[model samples]
Target: MDDLSKMGIDAARLPGWLRFVVVIVIVALAAGASLAAYRWYARPVTLSIAVGSLDGDAPRIVSALASRLAVNNAPVRLKLVETGGPIESAAAFSSGKTDLAVVRGDVGDLSQAQAIVVLTEAVALLVAPPGSAISDIAGL
Candidate 1:
């Protein structure tokens, strides 16, 4: 054909190496395109977690939780959703929009969701101001 002649690729005269190169290039391009498509579709899924109170140390605690979760190599991505209060956080967890949430042990009934892990035990410390006679448990 006139088009073939213009390209100077005399189909019959083209060496085997040239043909091989062309095939390799086409295969490489196809592989690259497939990889790009896979990456786009297999993007990580974000799992929202309701965190009680965005103020004060709450945000820091949430950040630490997220980091720990990441280190565990969980498949889903973690997103901290601040509910501004512990009550709201508990509600969010019960409602199902949030996958996980943090709340005080006595906050509410948690029979609906099973505990995956107990991170730590929360301790209550009683502090006395100034020169108080409170030295031990019986110093009231």
Candidate 2:
């Protein structure tokens, strides 16, 4: 048989099974590369977050998440908007100025707000300073 190399086909040197495997591998790599390129150019879903200065952790935490997503080529991203406080943040959200907000339930018109994460634990504790006159809610 004439050497296929003479025809400038290097893959023809491999055995039939090897040739099949090589083709499969090449196809898989091409598919993966195409997917990666598509993801790299894809527009991510951008979400605006309203965070308060008082709760500084909100911006820091969300920024970290957004960085991670960007590094991973994730489909979601957050844009942080710093507000004066929780109530102001909630107002921004309610007024359609932001898509998300870090807010306290007791501080705003939260009728339209949906809970995302509870940064602070809400627990009723009964305790006082060591030299206080009372030690419970009744002391108030």
Candidate 3:
């Protein structure tokens, strides 16, 4: 009591019950703030992805990936936006309809697109008749 008074706390002026209530209120407020912060930090971020393919494989693949991410509790999640094909997917991306997209390199407007991965590789082959004079690419 003497030390509190010397420190100018004036503990005697506050009722014991009132002091307990004040302490409880402070603790409750701190707990609430901690809960709010945890919820904010643990929230998952979802990004919309445009996917399409002639055989409908793109959408299926992306959907599976999204499901796996959710199941694994990943920090980043994907939302699939199905389109007709690569052209439509690219258009959706270009128009800001989707945050990401699975599109072919030669399709639509890709000026603002950045390559993240190569899904597939294609080789172009030029063949001629066996008796043709064209033996090489330059001879054609």
Best by TM-score: 3
Tens digits of lDDT, candidate 3, 1-140:
48988888787698999999999999999999999999999999999999999998888889999999999999999998988888999999999999999998899998898998787768999989779899788997
Q: Write one digit per residue (lDDT tens) for candidate 1, span 7-114.
A: 886787889999999999999999999999998887777788777764547767777877887887666677989887777888888888688877765565556777
Task: Please identify which of the two predictions, 1 or 2, would achieve the higher lDDT against the true structure.
Answer: 2
Q: What lDDT does candidate 1 reach at residue 28? A: 100
The residue-by-residue lDDT of candidate 2 on 1-140, one tens digit each, is: 35767777776466899888988999999999999999778879989998886747777877788789889977888887888878889889889999998777777777887787777777986768789988667778
For model 2, the stretches where C-alpha displacement exceeds 4 angstroms are 1-42, 120-140
Best by lDDT: 3
TM-scores for all candidates: the values are: 0.53, 0.56, 0.78
Worst 10 residues of 3 by lDDT: 113-122
Q: What value does the lDDT take at residue 110 in candidate 1?
A: 59
Worst 10-residue lDDT window, candidate 1: 104-113
Model 1: lDDT equals 0.79
Ranking of candidates on lDDT, top first: 3, 2, 1
- lDDT by candidate, in order shown: 0.79, 0.83, 0.92
Q: Give the TM-score (vs. native) of candidate 3.
A: 0.78
